[model samples]
Target: MTAWLSVIGIGEDGLDGLSSAARTLLGQAELIIGGERHLAMVPDDGRERLCWPRPLKAAIPEILARRGRRVAVLATGDPMCYGVGARLSRVVSADEMTIIPALSAFSLAAARMAWSLPDIETVTLHGRPAEMIIPCLYPGARILALTADGGTPGTVARILCEQGYPDSRMSVVEQMGGPAERRIDGIARDWPDGRAAELNTLAVECIAAPGTVAHPRLPGLPDDVFLHDGQLTKREVRAATLALLAPLPAQRLWDVGAGAGSIAIEWLRSHPNNKAVAIERAPERCALIARNAAALGAPLLEVVEGSAPQALAGLGAPDAVFIGGGIGAEGLVDTCWRALPPGGRLVANVVTVEGEKTVFECHQRLGGSLTRIAVCRGEAVGPYTGWKPLMPVTQWAAVKP
Candidate 1:
């Protein structure tokens, strides 16, 4: 007997903000689940109450157990907007739950600031690194950040100042849609008044410093941004490899023999939903991979330290697999190929004759496109400018049937 799950969205005004039907629903609820703050607002209806368990996920079993009963979950604003509803939907069937949404905090904040929600970038610093906002800090950018607590404003100020966007405007709009609503405004560089409410949102208007270099959102960030030990894929090859890899939303990649993790980093940068795992053998290279991933705004990238194919054990299936190093490792191609489901992509790049032979054999067996990439840049050749060619790379790319 599966219980019906009703997710009711509430705002800072609590029960007053809900409709008559919503209030009646709460009054009739047999079991109520919500955060401590939201649960406090209920009119002492004497319903069985449960605070969301630590980790939230651990409590899913109990929640599921209450199925087919008058079970109701309370959330703030739109439950679907960076709220528990999104997480629950992934585990629960759509028919099992009914989501009753209220105006989201993002929308309320936008109304307060008179900023169009669609025109501004929306992010949540709630349980996220402030550094993750790196990709959004271009001059003249508008962002609305859902903050976790008071410290988020200071963290935002420091990150913006570091990136030369010190003069950026920050409005800490707290307790929106309630009698305690307040707005604190300041610039990022001089964010001196750190006073903030426990429940607040950070709205930003970026103003970069004169000399600040804004990193663009694209594959192949500048090679100098990474900490590598001469083992990284060059900017040219990395860009080309990423193009061939073709990252899509919700896709995962496995960067086999990930040297400096440039491929994985760029793949992640392509889209927020994109995921990747960097498999590297060298201890130093693994450390470098972590550094580049964090600095470049893809901290979620998984770095597996050990050589393949032994290191590749128990890896999540990937939508794409790239072999940038250790192309000569035995059983590497076969293992990667067997791991990929149909429609998955595989690309390998090699500079040596032996490595080229391995790719060729795979191409023959697997049926993909093979090409030799010969890249050259102008160099001063004995007082005369001429094309200086770097070592040509043979690339084999294929998609699984």
Candidate 2:
């Protein structure tokens, strides 16, 4: 198919920065589409122009309607890098469009800060939760974030101070590659006010205060860190369970009967692309799961408050499923097993004898491995440290063939 859509990555420099081929396409285009700021950059050229509507997805149909027409789209930097072009590509194939590239915000910010792009983490806070960056906040880490507006810098600064990285350096580079370009720099504790422009990128150098709590991005987070009513999975068993589940990038997990949402939260923490849904029957536990997810830097964790096997309906199929609670619940395991695609994984942990019996039967029928997990911690026993054993856990793990 002949390409009719030309997606150009324009910078703050606007027309001056556009390549000759990009300029030619814009001149030939019968319709131009872009945000208000981007649309204002192009002078009245007698071509039809459309500013993006609220909820950008609403414009998809209009773009599709003009699929075969000469339509030009203006986007910031690289359209594939958290830009409208990426979203459009999902509905429009590569053969139907031409993409012209420009320097991304990450590249421009990295150049200004003298920071290496590969070494630092890059995230977009535009139209996303500020807490989404929490996972990237660690001592000695570097991050470049694309802001939604002027207030995002202060919001991120407050989060840094609250997370014990008060001394972290914050630099907001505004209007990059343009005449109005300027930058504001300070520590998170004393972030300068009213300096960030609406269009800007924030750079941070994480520096933790002494005695700050370190939350590593590992599966076995300390059980004490989570708020639970003794229904939480022990740290050791959680590690073993996660090892069996084997989370891969971009894979989705369904944590049935999630208690404290430990497995689901840790799965999200393992990789940014990883997603999870915590299905719990209790409303109070569902609320606790949300709290734990936010605190653990996995705010994207979806909490489904209802009994599983019924609540599982309408949810997108998962790459892996973990049943931590309700192991003995009738039809729960069968429903989850049926939901799995070929090569999909299922791992269930149980501590009760009845639950273990259910797991044993499933192991026999499903042809998977069953293992016992046990852990003991030292505790004070009459002024002497003695081993206090935790309840042993029986785990069943299988992959749908």
Candidate 3:
């Protein structure tokens, strides 16, 4: 039988916040494991203390391999709530562990601001990048972000400002649930100086202009919203293409040749749980995709700055796939089709004749639906009206056999 591991959640209040049961567990722990802050909480009376290595994932297995040890792992707040508990739980069986959770910083911050947690989106940048929070932002969306450090709030503020949401209200909750608990409220436009804390969580209230483009809930958002280099599929056509791809929740998507990331962004938008790895060769286009994703609340689009076929390796399999660009007469379609699992959908869109022919040939061999989409818009050429024909898009969609 594997020895039990006790994962305990502690707050800045230290032993004061600990329950009698938790304190007893700490006292009896033969091996106490925690971050520096957490280790300081327990009375240092000869219990073997271990600090986690730089990459926590690399350290977990070695620590767990030590058998017959009464190990106590300390985390901040609730162990399962954006804490280390969830990651540890994945590696260890439930039968081999007990979790003692305390008040989470999220709860404390929300309570301090009198905000209900269910109504708000919680993002943690503690050990992650600030960019991860971009996808969760929506007009009127309330956010509780566990900032990486003092620098994160500024980075978040800058990103929000750049995304045309400069007026969004933010409250910095520092040392939450502790004696030095402080809250600083201000608009993102005029972020207060010296208001940031190394250990703080931010409460953001997104405020967007009326009639601003509402966040799309589906993959393949209208193309007009993106600033593309004439290398993007238009809105209606993109939507149709995405439908053919058939994205599923929590599925990974390999968006090869993700020009402007229209297809990839839309894939992620389809389901908050869905993820996409967009491979685009152009640096400018990659940057554009990041900006568009950040602005539209789909910032989780993992942009890979490389061309497809060569870049496909080391990228894991996808449940669905979209090839929006770089589909030539040879190799591209075959590679993507081979990567799909049974029941997986592959949709490729092409505007150029050369690319269209390639798509047609792939459709012929793969046995899927093929269609050409022509989109035109009304423009006032003279006085009354004129119809302008945008270039047609040829699409091929196939399900893996």
Candidate 4:
């Protein structure tokens, strides 16, 4: 006999988001887990309310040990999206849990803006760094971003301003799907002066000059857009790497040695609602990545401007990862591989002989796909009489088993 855990998604409007069945489940549960706001939303009956203190990971196992007890965990929006349900599921089997999903804030914000969600890219910054969204931004792309807090809107505006999109139109939707909902509209160059809602989302419309970079498919962006200092993958090579990684909707990507952030940016561009975190040590490079993402329309790109493998700490697990620059670092490949789930994918790109050997060794140990790529272009060498070979790229792609 086992206890059942009910994970419920509530909205800013409180109990109104719950379905009749969900409400019944909450009423019957003896032990309830939630934040103060969610706890206050439930009808104050005799049901024992447990406040979730900091360090939720430590508390899960202890609470689950109490077998045969009914439990209900509360969360905002869909618990599965950037919420607590996934974390709980890591420890508890799916058979022991029931999830009741409500309208996600991203969806609500899109509706309020009178925009079709399928057509707009959406990213979440809640409980994540702003740098995570950098690679997704593209020129003329519309985006719906779930901000971490009130300060997020200003941060987004500042980032967009730093990029070339100073005139980009932005709409901030606050307290979405609730009675107190409000919407504010402005340009990135001149964000309106007002306190933003703690619970809010942003809508950005990218303005790009014609005949620059071609628009890519929803999830896979062309590699020509990013500004890199010879550390980035060419457009053709980047597309190949992303194809092997196979990013899905809502999955998070951990991009190491982000370099101009080609792989990370493409992951977000592949799916409107996808997420990623790009890690880079160079401050100037990090700033460049941020500008590239915002200009492209991924205002949610989170840039972790610190050196790895030290900077890799504190980041939660990712669905997939791409290692572009740090393959030769000691234990870097092993650390990333260990962090992945059984089905998680890791793709690394290399050019130098040392990098190739490192990736090959990792492939033999980890078991995945290996390939070499050679690209050449015909430069105008005295009226286009000769072909110049671009540097070859060695790619090793693998899935954790």
Candidate 5:
């Protein structure tokens, strides 16, 4: 098919910033589709114009309907970098569309700050939660964030302070590539209410305050980081469970009977693209799971408040499954086992004798490895420190052939 759709990337400089090819396509287009701000850049020409509808995906059919005709869709910066082009490409084939390039916000922000693009972590807060920035808040890290609106900078600053990086340097570069380009700088702890421009990119130079505790994106997070009511996986056991589960990029995990959602959250923290769903029976624990997910920068973690086996219905098949509780629940393990595709992993940890028997039976039938993990911590006994043993855990891990 001839490329009838032209997805052009435009910067804040508007028409002046567009390439000759992008401009010619826009001039020849019969229908122009974009946000009101982007549409305003072009004077009312003879072409039919469309402002993006509520829930942007609603306009997909309209774009598809005019498939053979000249259609130009305007987007900010590089359309592939967290823009509408990526979403539209899923439905519109590359052969039918020509994607034009422009300087992305990240590129502009890095230039203004004199920072190396490859060294910084770039994320989008546009239509996403602020907590998504939490996982990227380590000391000496550089981040470039595309803000949702004017209020995002303050929210980012608040999160920085709460996460023990109060002394971090913050810079908001407003209206990049435009004549009104401006930069505002401040420390995260003392970030003022100087409302940033709507079209702005936030840059952060993460500097830890004195005595700030570092929480690296590793499997073994301290148990206290999660809010739990005794129905929690201890730190060491949780780490062991994650090690067996083996998180990878863009892989999804099903955390069955997620108590305080530690395992699922840790799985998400391991990689930005990793996804997890926490299934819990209690309503209060479900709410706590959400809190933990948001606090730990895994706001994308889905919390299903119901018992397993039935709740697992309609959920997308996972790359890995971790059964932390409900080992005695009928058909729960079987349901999870059957859902795995070839090479999928399943790990179950149980502390009780009845649960251990079930795991043992599963190992005998499934032909996988079994592991027993016992942890002991030192505690004060009068003037002496003695090792106190916690409940031992029996784990069964299998890879579907």
Candidate 6:
């Protein structure tokens, strides 16, 4: 058994809360690895101790070298639940490791609140910005968020006020499973963020204030919700593009020429596992992409600043790719077509005549449907309402064979 590694979950109470099996395994550990906080739990164990190195993902090789030795990793709550165990598991062989789980903080928090775990949503603001919680702010929703530090509650509180959830009730539950464990309750508008301790988890009982129109978490989010500089993919067309892209579980997308990052944002909003990378040439647009993604709850969207083809290099092949601009650029479409694997979807939209010609020529050779989307909205013309035609968009979409 010493030849395989054992990753153990220890709580705030440290060794006192561990099971007999976990205690025995930890006792025999020839080498232990954990953060400074978790390391303080065990005293004079008479074993070699190694602090978890910085950039933990990059430290995998050093960890794997200790394999076949009596090695133990101390983790918080459940190691598989957004802990280092999951990170290392991606690089280390599963055959050489065993994971022992403890009760998760979410489980404990839900239990304390008497809220059913399945009925409530759980997210971790751990090492994440509070703006990333926007997608979960709809009325009547309950959320258990793991906070990074004492300041996280304040940040969350401010975000709620801006997002029209000022009346949402909050619970700052501190140091769960420890002697210091306690819950401080208040509304988002009056949250005593500074009063809460560092090691805390926040539970939200969402109740949108009166007349605070909520941004419904759906494919067709209204255009006004995003802070764009007039250059936007119209709401109706954006919805159609997302439907054509067909976001699926665990799929990744490349949003090339991501003017306002609407497509990528919607793709991420579709599912938690869904991922996207926004590539834009203009620095201003890239900035918008980051802010829009964070504000809309997909902060994980990677924004790379550079034109396509050059920027697309070294990027992981995407499950789907959307070209929202620069359709007339030479070799841009060809590179995207070749980069996609079989069954991968590629969709591009254009408005200019030159851009349409490019897409039409590609359709003739590649054989995808060419569609001209023309939308007309009601407008006041002197006396009565009249139909106002907007710029027509030509869209071409195909799957790699």
Candidate 5 — what's its lDDT? 0.92
> lDDT for each of the candidates?
0.88, 0.92, 0.82, 0.80, 0.92, 0.86
- lDDT, candidate 4, 1-401, per-residue tens: 34388899999888876899898888889888899878988777776778887877777875677546888999889999778888888888888888998988777877777888888777777776565444445687788888888988888777666555667788988888779888899988899756598888888887643444445554445555668787787877877888888988898899999988767777876665778899999988898888777656555668998877788888878888898887888888888888889889999989899998998898888888889899887778886567789889999999888
- Model 3 score (lDDT): 0.82
The reply for model 4, stretches above 4 Å from the true place, is 1-3, 43-47, 193-195, 209-375, 382-386, 391-401
Pitting candidate 5 against candidate 6, the one with the higher TM-score is 5
Candidate 2 per-residue lDDT over residues 49-149, each given as its tens digit: 98999988898899899978999999999999999889989999999999998899999999999999999988888987777788888889999999999
After TM-score superposition, what is the CA distance of residue 188 in candidate 4 from its true location, in Å?
2.0
TM-score of each: 0.95, 0.97, 0.89, 0.67, 0.96, 0.93
What lDDT does candidate 2 reach at residue 100? 96
* Alpha-carbon RMSD to native, per candidate: 1.9, 1.4, 2.6, 5.8, 1.5, 2.1
Candidate 5, superposed: residue stretches over 4 Å from native = none
Residue 188, candidate 1: Cα error in Å is 1.7
Collision count for each candidate, in order? 5, 0, 3, 22, 0, 0
lDDT for 135 in candidate 2 is 83
Tens digits of per-residue lDDT, candidate 1, 356-400, equal: 999999999999999989989899999899998988989999999
Q: How accurate locally is residue 352 in candidate 2, as Cα lDDT from 0 to 100?
A: 92
lDDT of 6 by residue, 1-401 (tens): 32368889988889999998888888888888898989999897578998887777666777788778788899999999889889878876787787888888898899888899999888888987676688788899899898889888888888888888999888888999999898888888987636568888889888887887767556888888777887688898999998888888889999999999999998998777688999999999889989899888888999999988889998988989999998887788899889888888999999999988999999999987888899999999999999999899999999889
Number of the top lDDT candidate: 5
Candidate 1 vs candidate 2: the lDDT winner is: 2
User: Which ten residues in a row are the worst by lDDT in model 3?
Assistant: 211-220
